[model samples]
Target: MPSPSLPPELLLLVVEAVLPPNPYQLLPASHISTRTLLALTRVSRATHAQATRLLRQRCAFVDSSRRLADLLLCMPRLVPGLPPVLSLRHLTALYIAPFGASLDDLPTAVWVRELFCEVCETLRRLVVQMPFGSLDPLDDHLSVRRTLRDGFEQLHRLEEFVCVGEYPALSVPDGHTDVWRLWPELKRLVLFGVPMDSHWLWWDIATLPRLEHVVLARPVRLDAVNIKDEYFHKLPREDVRLSRDIKVVLMDLVYDLGVVRTERWKEIDPEEKMTVEVFEVPLPFYGDETPLELVTEWARRGALDGSVWKLDATKVRQEEGSDG
Candidate 1:
């Protein structure tokens, strides 16, 4: 008996089934040549459909210095028949670099469900590098805040937000506050290199019922004249019943070699005001060798004082030495 000959359509189907899901890895396979790929597309309608879906799903565009804007602008023209990979329901995550082009360049119809915008937001998870300059330029700062707010308003199901830049001021405007209100489902938040005086915003954050974790880094110190305790009074108490349901992690970096002071929260009853515990930890230099150790020691101290706190020493140490 003779063995049956495999049809071209069946051969393509077998190749597609065996190829890696990622195009970068699959391109090196035997049947991945341009002629073979074109033939596979023509042999069966199912093969054609699967190939198109796979190609679009694994697509990635990386532009380091914002020059990719020109190429991105030409995508629709160069591939007029192909649909955008960044449709509203399919987009899960996006990452951009510091000097990348703005999202305003993208068509408004293009929707991203979860985005990591490094320069600015017209995208999600907007992560901006802290600019090295004076914070007095209110207009410039306001423009950026407005852009972020606009982007936030568009994401109906945004669940996580991160900001890596220095906040301009403690007094966030009404428009920005309104955008924050829109994100009721936000679960995790991270703010790095933000102004210390912005602690006032913690009051606003307490209103977020679903928030589980809050991480803050490189907080800027406010002058004595600008210090206000009204927001502090609104801060979540240390009591289990009164405490904020979320965990708060703060890492203070010491730029100057000055002594750091810790705060002690006290509960005032009708009879007397008594100190429950004293929380103290040294502020290490931003890039110091034991920065994580310092934070860990602070957290350990907090835990000893009856505060519900835990620290991932391994993660902190690993991250301390990482470029990120």
Candidate 2:
């Protein structure tokens, strides 16, 4: 007697069960699911198709150089009769995390360019974690910067763009303003900082046709106090009348995980709430968390609007004669 085989749907469900929930993590060890999925692929032809589909859907687990090399190697060359094992066109989301080295290395840069070219049309979300000092305006990094900028321009279908690890508030030459205009479908943008030299970038961001949420995870400028005055004064009222939501997350200067500030612009009109809500954590929290993590937590629980929040740091500080 032969053993019974499982249905394709059930097999795919099993594959999905083992996949990592948060694929954006930087540590390779966190993606133990990668091994499990690879094992499932070897079970049979039916299992290979289902497992490979999930593997190609999100490429966030490729954290190290060796994994990246293997990903590229899996791409099949144009053969007469054989079907492609894995297709880059199937990918919809990608996370690029440059750990310690620059993405400008010869092999790595080539891989980046090729990967971008392959997924340019289909990719809808991108999260980049650049190592600090990687995007500096030095002659050595000019070519790599151009490659990255060009790659950004090619992603017409991109909806969400998140860049962590460092501030993107560079000079006009490397300004994110230039790169953002190309993404017409972009809806959510998460950045560490915003350029304070001028108001044009902020206005430009608001003007985007589909943009709705702008999260400055850790703004060096535009604190809880100054944003109420300094931020809106700069943008042209006529140009920024369009409705949009902007969130500014600031950290306490002295304490590690002290306070989280979120300012939301429900509408362009100044008469609206337009208030900054502060979250005072009474319980001890993890010190290793990033600002983006906190922002995500608030967003997940629908606490971003500050309606249920009790503490208002801006008013409390003002009453105490302390500036935010």
Candidate 3:
């Protein structure tokens, strides 16, 4: 007998305890070490089944293109118009950044985008990072973002979202209704790969009363005026009452920028500057591990409240002290 000869039920509990509690981390092949994975798989059929359930619930693999294709192949028999065999209703977290830098991999990109959209209805935590070198043809870039926007538009259940991609001009045309409803359930949003011209999201993001934690990436752009808005959110004064008490986290700050330049981001709202916190990590990948850990804590648990999340997008906030 093995050690104390524990029962199967107890053994299953032990296995689960050793595993990552986050459902998305249940990937046996990836998250689990080779030896641990083998040991878990060898335990018994029931243990295997449990492991399989975890895999089905969350796919937190770093390389998404290959695994997603494999998953697509496994989804029932080449059906026509049938709802997927794996709708992933129980999925809670996902991490998908580009695996490589190649404009030719547009097909894989499309597939990954589609796959994420399909499961958006239930996912609570999501991270999508676009490769800096991936945007070549303008059409493909715009099209993918549009698809992503549409996908996000319907996600009333998502809690935490991390998007690192080309978000230069998410311009809201004057008469478009129902724009802010895109992220009603969102609590924490971490953005990387922020475009130089991307000032549009600041107003929308800060005003989201439901939002608690916001993180943004500041590329090492030091032309002073050139990177004026990097890792910055300018909350208009008039609409400040409608906003929640949000804490801002700045990841990967470009060190040489100096305190004088950094303080200028607060000109929009100096008091709002108090809400900001900076995490000093060496950039390029922000060490990769830290971001995921932060995301996990952010996405792990949060009670959603309908009343506090109320937003009246119709009444736009004109910039305070503006000459216009």
Candidate 4:
């Protein structure tokens, strides 16, 4: 009599048992243990398939320079009629950490373009935290620039896109137009800490046919007066062409007081057939939560289905010493 074999479905569940609760959160590479995944992949061909998929999904969290370099150096190992290694082909969502050690020596542009090329057909959500000085590598090489642009154009299926940094990710040196038109299927776009000159992004926003929500955000501080000007001035009332209503959300995070203070306004452009709504929400909490974490969570929730507006009731103030 032959020994009984465990079903593949059961094997997948066993493999998933080792995954962290929130695998997508940015965590230190050392904190993540892959010994189990490696052991399982060596167990059998069936286990290898399942473990490979899990590992590929893990690449979505590009948290450190080492992790980014690993991804850049990864090569695909395809099994007959099966998914390849480095799991780029199976990826659907990605998040780039907002803060980390400077990754200057790596070919950041090639890595980004390679990932984009493989996942362009499948990726639905992307959150890029492009910190100051991060964009220099991408703009340094001419061939790299063109290839990156081509890869960007191929992401037609992406639904939610977020860019957060001191400078706009899409800023062009020569002032190119209609760049936003590339993502015909984009539904939600979130931009934070955008520079003063990125007002051109508004023109791109108007070109997205399926765009329903646009979020512009900044941290609340003494210089927020200038921040307000930079964000508000981007909202143009003219030449807006849309068949249905779209909402533009402006948010400001007050980190010191553990509050998110927001103001919403509604602008009805009759000639342009677009309705822009600015929603005001003030949410306070007590914890070690960071501004980037809070904003990323807010943007992702709203991007999924626009249910972020339901947090309106949480706008009420909670007293400092109260235990309620």
Best by lDDT: 4
Task: Estimate, for each residue in 215-317, the C-alpha lDDT of model 2 and write its tens digit.
Answer: 5434544433344444455456554434445443332222433322223322223553233434332223656655455544433222212221222333223
Give TM-scores for every candidate, taking all chains together and pairing residue i with residue i: 0.45, 0.68, 0.61, 0.60
Off by over 4 Å in 2: 20-30, 77-86, 99-107, 169-176, 196-198, 224-241, 244-324
Ranking by lDDT: 4, 2, 3, 1
Question: With candidate 3 superimposed using the best TM-score fit, by how many Å does residue 95's alpha carbon deviate from the native?
Answer: 1.5
Candidate 1 residue lDDT tens string, 1-324? 899977757765674664444333212123344335545545555465555444323222222423234324433432234433333224222222323233231222122211222212222232222231333326443345344345446655555554433332322355535354466667656554445455446555556666666555444452311211322355454533224344445445344212222222211222212111112345644655565346444432332222322333112111222221
The superposed Cα distance between candidate 1 and the true structure at residue 66, in angstroms, equals: 4.0
lDDT of each: 0.38, 0.53, 0.48, 0.55
Look at candidate 1 and give me any clashing residue pairs: 196-220
Maximum-TM-score candidate = 2
Q: Encode model 3's per-residue lDDT on 37-61: one tens digit a residue.
A: 4466556655665544454444444
Model 1: runs farther than 4 Å from truth?
A: 1-89, 98-145, 168-182, 197-199, 222-244, 252-324
- Model 4 misplaced stretches (Cα beyond 4 Å): 1-5, 16-39, 79-87, 97-106, 132-154, 174-181, 195-199, 219-241, 254-324
